[model samples]
Target chain A: MSTADIAGKARAPWMALDKLGVLIALIAVAGTVLPFAVFRANRIVLGEGLQIPFALEALPALVLGVLIALGIAIALMALSPLVKLVGGFVLLGALMILIGLAATGLIPPGDSFARVSPGAGFWVLVFAFALMVTDALARLRLGPWQRITILALVGAALGSLLWAGTFDDLSILKEYANRAPAFWAEARTHLVLAFGSVAIAIVAGVPLGIVLYRIRPLRAAVLNVLNIVQTIPSIALFGLLIAPLAWVAANVPGASAIGISGIGLAPAMVALFAYSLLPIVSNTLVGLVNVPETANDAARGMGMTDRQRLMGVELPLAFPVVLTGIRIVLVQNIGLATIAALIGGGGFGVFVFQGIGQTAMDLVLLGAVPTVALAFAAAVVLDALVEMASTRERAR
Target chain B: MRAGLLIRLVVFALLVAFLVNPEAFAFVFAPLASNGQPVIYNQGSLLDLTLNHLMIVLIATTLATLVAVGLAILVTRPFGAEFLPLSRSLANVGQTFPPVAVLALAVPMLGFGTAPTLVALFLYGLLPIFENTLTGLTGLRGPVTEAARGMGMTGLQRLTRVELPLALPVILAGVRLSTVISLATATIGSTVAARTLGEVIIAGLLSGNTAFVLQGGLIVGVLAVLIYDGLSAIERTLSRRIGQRARA
Candidate 1:
């Protein structure tokens, strides 16, 4: 009914998460119950013609009822502070999330309910996140506040959904949540498979790129390898790895059973990492090469050594661009990480594969939402890092 | 454009090694499978897979070019000066988020198949095409337009005859980029039930077969990159023709 001012520009952090705001927290609690209500509450719901049931039922209710209602209330309130105007849409989105939960009925009172899986709750949040993102991305006629508030809301919606496992099946979450030790086992398994291979890629790719760049004879050779590597399909790449890695593991110490545990994560990470190398390497090469000819000349004129010029002038200037490459790689890695699920690597792919296996739309969200959200979150974080690094360079 | 002699030798060696040696093939295929499980290669039948992948990427790229080129043209009109930043930012969003997310969201509506994959690829391809097209069109000089008008060329004539000829190279580069990315991304179409080379990779992943994955990955990757390079060459050639005429 009423609007409020955001914190001062001097207090940027206070305005960020809005720690004091409860924000559909009640709905989150209700997440454990919305399934029954959704199944029960039908205004003769017309399902979306070409959608999964969860989306089919939930989107219109939220868009038509909540998003529109809020759109109108704010439409009339011209005097609403700029921050609240954006935040109002966010709150409306949060409210619609509550309705979405009820509309989808993620947490059913009984099996008799239309009985979308628990993951429906998460998808509700995902839909809200999409809504918020679309809203944020729409345009900002106002100021930094509008963009910040809208973007923050989109982030918050996505984060909360992931945190709550709203987009996934309850069975897996409950199983994982209750079976903490097994979850840990799985977690360690994934962390190792995912992080380990990616680490290997970073180590190998950077030097390889630099070496290739520096050596005239090797540049084309290495670049061709890079290009070839860039082109290899991850599926094919993974398939290619299986035989040798298996041979090594079986014959070699402690390696044979690595990917044999029902074919999930390990191979996926390997394939993903292989895919990751090109962007990192090429970007680094490009960034390094892009050094102004004059800048290099100046370093030479100043009597700097090659190493000094590289460390002092080139790497620093090129750091931003190289990091931009890394950023792209990292975000790409997150998406590819989902493919690791095909190999049983875990992360968000579990739900996706499960969805495919069970032929249930709800189960798919278990993997899909998190995969999408994780990729997006990674993109945002890397984006922020890129902005910070570039701005710092500019300041310098 | 000729590479140095030693560099050329290395390239030849790598090409020979990859095309000939079983060991070199191993490097390419090792990661595609797991547990010696024949995980990759010949995922479904070959023809269906190839067709699916090609269609998805090709359709997406074509659609993206149409929409992006149209939008770019509109925004380059005289009245569009005030909105350049906004258009640029929208294009950024096309690249900013993960394309996988776009595919996931699209899958539900379009159903799990090539349609969803096509949409994802289209959105993914949109940014590069939009920006390059915009830059190419907007980079036009006032004198060129004045000369066209003095020569009594109509608006459409000016756009199609003069501006398009000049902007073709830059625009084609964008098309090349978007096409290569779409080709790689056609792999994701598998999850949505759109057949492609991804089936081979996913199979290898499931079966733990590296060779199959490698085979598919290598073929697709080489094909995509070479195509990209070839397109780039075509762009260079076009630019040179225009460039030579301009110089004259």
Candidate 2:
């Protein structure tokens, strides 16, 4: 065959089906066929599942119609970016609304004992559509500003929906409402533990990194020690600290005054700080080491001291890499901070462990969803910062 | 040098002594326990706990490495290149997602036990292996593969004889990392009723016994460090045998 004929053959519809579309289609089929929500007599007991038809029994037929139409649209429109993006958003919005309505409709009126939760199929549908939208966004290749704007818009939309009590009927939301005050308090504590540990690590680790960079022999030894520390399981590290810290709190003067104890925030913070050190110090060292020697030479030619070179020349150039290390630490610490709840450090993990103890999955989601969101947001923001920092450096 | 060696020997001897007859060292841990509470973790033998812990980590890390490396290999092939972005994002998501959260989420679907913990550990361990294997397989120098192709080796033969051998050390580094991380992560499995070392620690936490916590922490920490060091040594030796510098 001629080249043109071959090219046309290769570009045929069936030959060029979008792979992501296939995945979405498969997930959609599974989602449509499986239960969308579960209806329970109470929060703790296993519940009966409500498939799409039963789930939509409470809502108008139009909701189910929209849901089906959106699924098909998303699957078919995968090759068209704008259509895919809009379809993904619309599908996600429809799913959320349907879930809330389904929960509201499923629950017996004035029956406080009933619980309605989004089921496996609901999650599958959400995941598929979210993936679809994310793929479309990636294809758009938006700049940093546009990406941030989208992130904010998504956040605001979710926040407003949450604030307006759109999902208050959902079991997870009911759990949240029950512990609204505690939830906020734990959210603050989670942020603090995650950010605070990294802050301390940065303050301490940067200098250590700089010192080690200057003194080559110390770098390997210090990093090795830190690496060993990093290898320790976070729980083990936290556990290991309890005895010494408890001893200090009991016997040492002014220790308890500052909240030093065996099982709580002290051990948690110390453990997180220890874990944070290796990433921060190593990345800082790498960044400083990678600073252009020509820049150093120029600084020297200007009669700049070692300290001056670090502050004015080397550190500025190295900031992005150091920030990268900080980013890794932050995302890591946010996750680790959940474990802090086990030690009484008071984070979202409180809900997690408590839920596990009570076999309350909704309560567990109350903790996990936020922790994941926080970590994901931290990763995104820091990633953008890292990008901006490097671009700025390049311009300079 | 002699003094340092002597100090090391003494420490080693003391460790052995503590292991052989731990009750003798009970006095040292006395301050950690409340009245009538045991000064050592007694829920299970320390050795068993350590072995069980290692078993969970081993299973999870091995499965993760197999799946991740397999997926990486598939994506690197021309026919599977379309999947590269999806696989990459999945790996990234796996990394960013925390093990504890995964464990908690899994509990709802899979219910409590070693099974959910295995799923969590498997997901948690995928990213490093996937990324490293991708890097190893794709980052191969062009001429080496070109030569293999020119020698008339089939695609399967070239991959097995040339590509995999060259990439083994790098892939091993990923395995080492995943294994070490899994070592720590399996401890959390105890929270989900998994028969792991974290049971001791959690029990200690619940009972307000610092001794149990200390004992559990010490064992897990030691196991992690030992495994990490052992794997590092193996990775180094493998890299040396292949005439390539170890990345670390």
Candidate 3:
């Protein structure tokens, strides 16, 4: 075979795997598992009682801590091809986190983040694997500058954690500042949930956005409902969920126990998902409209079916603009999602609400700092993804 | 164009139907729990309080326009391009920083009064106003600016007689967006005990009186958004007039 042909064949699997979400899954699982397995002690104290092989009840938190650290690690190492220096920095950073956990006896648990405790090692491996595979595919789409930006964001996130702190029930800024690591451990859950929900939002919304755009009546109808949905104040809507859902869960036998809510993550995620739809949907519609009538006509002239025209032409052409909308939605939600803590949806917001209740500013930062960083990172990543994925911008 | 108009008309009709029968509207508009509350019309009505809210929006938008346009002119002066984005970013950061948070911080220093609300409104209104002003002015091609200077115009003369006049259309558009956002945001003023129509909505949300809360929220929300639309129409008309005058 020609060398060009050989290279194409070799790269195809990796490229195909990346598209299938294998890369992010690998990152998430490996990054989550190995770190947790190696650093269980960093999660909790060897509390006063001893019955099992592990003296501390911190293993659940250790898994979560490892997953967040891995998100940082992958976000950092994803830059290795561009910077060469970041890969080493990520390892060193991970090591330092492990050491710091060893120094602090606080395992930081017994809260909502530990809700789905399926054994830290097991969950870590699975999540990291999934996250890694997904990211690998996305990595192919990102360019050098985009990779550099992600690395820089990952660095800033680490720095923010240092700056932000884990006041956990301390209520005082000074105390929270001292216990920054634990505070970050708490903040990690919120960031993960938001990221996870936004991920699902993209999976569902992006294609649906494409579908609705092509069908004029559907677009008009869906967009109108979304507009009205946007008008409802977030807390009020979330509070509204309490009465009906609580009633439904009480009566609806096998249904309530399933979904993400169980009265906790369910409503918080639903509320965030609803709030998220307006921007994503509108932006998609606006961006798709801007896709130039000429292109849509050309796609049709080529004898392409409606589906081909949407996927092969309009959606790709309109992606960057659609991303801008997603960025707005994601950024706004990161801040507003803090309200989720009020309903037992874990994240950095736990501190914001708790602090507000007690009138403690330090506690609020425990939630606020990471939230701001997460929003910033999300904004940057959306830009990178849009830039990398679109061939139209490449011609520039 | 015809389609958009038809769609807006249908939406308006639906809005009327909902307003006339809030109980039915509640199923579609308010969350399920927010039905069956009774309204006390005298204390709860927003129609009577329209002037107060409208003035707040108008005055705040005007102040925002003046500051934003002034800043836009200074930035566009021979040395503008480099500094313009920085100013734009600050305005964005201002808008993005949640008006509620800004109001909270401003309250402690400005005290329990309208002054704090004004400052918060001004800050909140800066983004759209500044962006539109900058977008409208600097985007003027070199020939346009040069022609004004050729007329023996001083820098200030160039700005008022040429740049500002030509840029008015776009700046007003920006003002419309800013004014609407500010009107909605100003409702947070109620938290600090500042007098505005928002007091009803906030009171309703905090108390769980479904009917009272719905009426108060519905009234304030409708008025704020409608006024937003009203100001937009005025902006379009004003922009058209300015453009026509400049052409003349």
RMSD of every candidate to native, in Å, equals: 9.7, 2.6, 15.3
Local accuracy of candidate 1 as per-residue lDDT tens digits, A161-267 = 75765533333343344445644564455445545665777788777767766876877667667666666655455555555556666676666444442245556
lDDT of 3 by residue, A1-396 (tens): 899788867774424222213333455445444323222221122212221123123773564455455554544342332232343244444433443343233334654221111133433444444233233424345574756565686577667755654212222334364566867766666765666667777777777787787687898678767765565555445554555566566688765768533246777777778877777777777778788888888889999998898789877777787787777777777766666664567666666545544543334445555566566566556656766666557684
> Which candidate model has the greater lDDT, 1 or 3?
1
TM-score of each: 0.70, 0.94, 0.60
For candidate 1 chain A, which ten residues in a row score worst on lDDT? A40-49
True contacts kept of 1: 0.38
**DockQ of each candidate relative to the true complex:** 0.28, 0.70, 0.06
* lDDT at B227, model 1: 67
lDDT of 2 by residue, B89-203 (tens): 6666556777788998898878898999999899888889999899899999999999999999998898889898899888988998898778877899899999998999999
The DockQ-derived docking category for candidate 3 is: incorrect
Task: Compose the digit string of candidate 1's lDDT tens values, residues B21-128.
Answer: 444355454554446544224335454566667777878899999999988887776655434555675565546445545666576458777788888899889989
Q: Give the CA lDDT, 0 to 100, for residue A368 in model 2.
A: 89
Give the winner by DockQ: 1 or 3: 1
Best by DockQ: 2
Global fold similarity of model 3 (TM-score) = 0.60
Misplaced by over 4 Å in model 3 are: A1-212, A217-275, A292-303, A339-359, A388-392, B1-60, B79-82, B92-96, B111-117, B141-154, B192-207, B238-248
Which candidate achieves the best TM-score against the true structure?
2
TM-score of predicted chain B, candidate 2: 0.90
Give model 2's docking category: medium
